[model samples]
Each structure stands twice: as C-alpha cells, then as structure tokens.
Target: MTTKSSLNAAPRRFALINDRIITAPKEVVPVSVLRALASIAADQVLVRDHGSPNDMVLDDRATVDLNDGNVFYTRARCDATPPAACGSPAKLAFAVDDTFELSTAAELPFEAFMALFGLEAGKQLFRDFESPNDQPVAPGSVLRFKDGPVFYTRGGQHHDARVEITIDGVKHKVAPGKTSGADLKKIGNVPLADELIQNIGGKLTPLADDATLCIAGGEEFVSHPRCGASS
Candidate 1:
C-alpha cells in the first residue's frame, strides 16, 4: 500500500534515455530489457549499482533499473570516450506464450531483462506471472547469437502490458491497469479547464475527467481547451 507521505518521503528515481528525471512507482522495479536498451541508441549500457563498486551492462538495452533511496548511472561498454554502438544488434523477440507483441534487438544483460515474463508485478504487467526463469547465461555474459531470444509462456497472461501512448502529441509509456481519468490528465499535465480526447479507430471520443480507463497500450490522446462547462 502506497501513501502520499510514502511517495513524498522516498521517491524512487531514474533517468529516461532522453535523460528525463523519472520517479519510480516502487522501491525496486523490474523493467522490460527490450524497451530499456532501445531507449538509448548506438551502444550498450553499463549500470553502476547505487552506492557500490558493482556495475551491470546492457547489450542492447537503453534503460536502467530504478531502486528506492538510490540513484544509478548508465555508461557504455565500448572503449569510445563517450561510448557508441560498437557491437551489432542481435534480433530479440518476446511474447506471452505465442502472442508476441514486441520484436527487438539482441544480447541484452541478464539484470537488464525483466521476466516472470512480465516487466514488473504490481503494475499488472502480466496476470499471475512471476519472473523470467533462469537461463544458462550469467549476468555479465553476452549471448549475441543471430537467432531468437524469443520468449513464450504455457498459460497466456498477456493482458494489457505497458505500451506507448501519446498525450498532447508527445509519446509516453502507459502501464496497463485500472486508470483514472485524472491520471491521464496528469500524464500530459492537462489543465483543470481543458479536455482530453481519445482517437480510437479514427474516431474522436471525448474523455471524462471522472472516467476509468483500461488501457490497451499504444493509444493516442489529444488535449484542447474545454468548449463549455457540462450542464
């Protein structure tokens, strides 16, 4: 159970691939390896453990893990002064059983990959899913083969996964679950007097401020000034 005081007292923090200051919803979270690495381009990432000498690398990942009460930084695995994509990408595709949703690059770090077959648990990433099973690879080892790192599950739990959404014309990631209309407004910072419109199947639908949304991921939203107050 999260309280406002809890969020205020301790905010889990990390930086986006664009270096945006992001607040984590949990103390420690598991992120999708495919998405994380893709956030950065041209190179692999090295994750420095929050206040320790240990470091982790991402072979194809551009994202980093978020830990509560800690801050982590990402670096490249290459010898280049600023780091650049030195190794070629390996094709990686993942799915819940056979319903593959995301197809991406390769040879990602172990810590970088999120499993139980879901990115994380609380956000309802995959229903009843735990974590990804252990593989023969080590955390620091590289598995850049040309084939598939493709994933599958026995009982499909690929419900609403985290997806990319557009708020006010800017793309943002939306975690799947019961969403409040206010939450969407906060995502795009829509004003109290403004309105949010959802474009679905080429149809324009006005979203209510009190509505609850079950996001299917990859949805688009637009904001505009309210025409008039509701009767």
Candidate 2:
C-alpha cells in the first residue's frame, strides 16, 4: 500500500525539451504538443534522442517518457541569434511553470508592456492600466530587475488558459486569443478547414468568432447544419 509519506518522498521528475525542463509524473498522460512547440517559438527543426524527429501530429497529444532521456535538440536558424546573446538593453523577471526565469528585452521604442512582448496593442498589462493605449510606458516600467530578457507572458490572459476543441474529429487546444485560421493551423498541426465547425448547445454552428477563446465543443445541428457538408 502506498502511503502519503512515500508519495511525498518521491523526487519530482522532469523532461528536458529545448533547454526547458518540464515536470513529468509517474502516470503517463496526454499533453499539448503545440503548446510545447510554441514555448520554443523558433523557426527550426527539433530532434529527439539525437535522431528521432520531434514532430507534432494532428491529435497533438504527447507523453513525456521518463524511460527515455527526454532530450531534444534544435536546428536553429543560421541568421537568428539566441536571445541571451542578443545583448538586450534590459531584463525582465517572471515565473513560468513555477520556475523563476528571466528574458532579454529589445532595445527599441517604448510601448505598452504587452506590446513589448509582441502582443496586439491595447491588451492590458497584468490586467491593469495606468493610462490609455496611446500613452506608452517607457521600457523597464513593468519589471523590477530591468536588466535582462523581458518575461511578460505571465501578464497575459493566455498565460495558462487554453481553449480546447475538436477540429474535424481530433481533440486539441490552442492558447487563448489564437483561434484564427493561421494560428489554428500552427497549433493543431493540421490544415485549416474550408468550413469552420464548432460545437454549441448540443448542435454545430459556423465558427464566426475566430478571435476569442470562449469556444468549446458542442453538438452539430443535423438539420441545416451550419458547419456540415452543406456549407
């Protein structure tokens, strides 16, 4: 019989991917491959265990196998420089996956905090606003350290929240505010459907709002289905 003390005594396990180590549990479970890929956010190929291709599938479900060394290598772009070596003008500190981390900030024009992170303008910073969007906040306004890479994803709505849905028939989830044609394709590892399908109230509906994250799986309307073969 397993006791609470024994469970506590077990050391946590982690899998290393693209330099980031992600927590893994004793039980194998499904995780979003796209999300993990997005975390790297680089134009390059990834290989696992030296030779195995680290490719994401339509289902996008993956398990971090502890038996394997859980190693991944990136074939980064030739022209691209690692953020750490970019000689950023400032640094921002934040927490990702309960791990405190830092990132370099671009030495460019001062803008809103979210804008600093390449987000759409007018998105609030840490869900707060000191002034209107037109009023730009100077660089380093959001971080106390103000000397390394800017870690601002922790301030956005999509920090941990993702919208799950079934595209065609596979189950997958994309980060909030990223449900559009181009974004969904990248996240779901599949082609964009000529016709958008969404589940709503035990019925299927034409997916009109591709910008918001409130979407979920619903029933398709059998008669005059909005997202069916008739479309």
Highest lDDT: give the candidate number: 1
TM-score of every model versus the real structure = 0.32, 0.26
Return the lDDT, model 2, position 169: 60
Taking all chains together, the TM-score of candidate 2 against the true structure is 0.26
Best by TM-score: 1
* Candidate 2: count of backbone clashes, pairs at least 3 residues apart or interchain: 13
Which residues of candidate 1, in runs, are more than 4 Å off?
1-161, 227-231
Question: What is the per-residue lDDT of model 1 for residues 90-196, given as tens digits with 9 covering 90 to 100?
Answer: 22233333333222333444334444245432222221122111112223443231222233222223343446778888886655566666678877778867888
Please report, as a residue range, the 10-residue window in candidate 2 with the lowest summed lDDT: 127-136
True-vs-predicted CA distance for residue 97, candidate 2, Å? 13
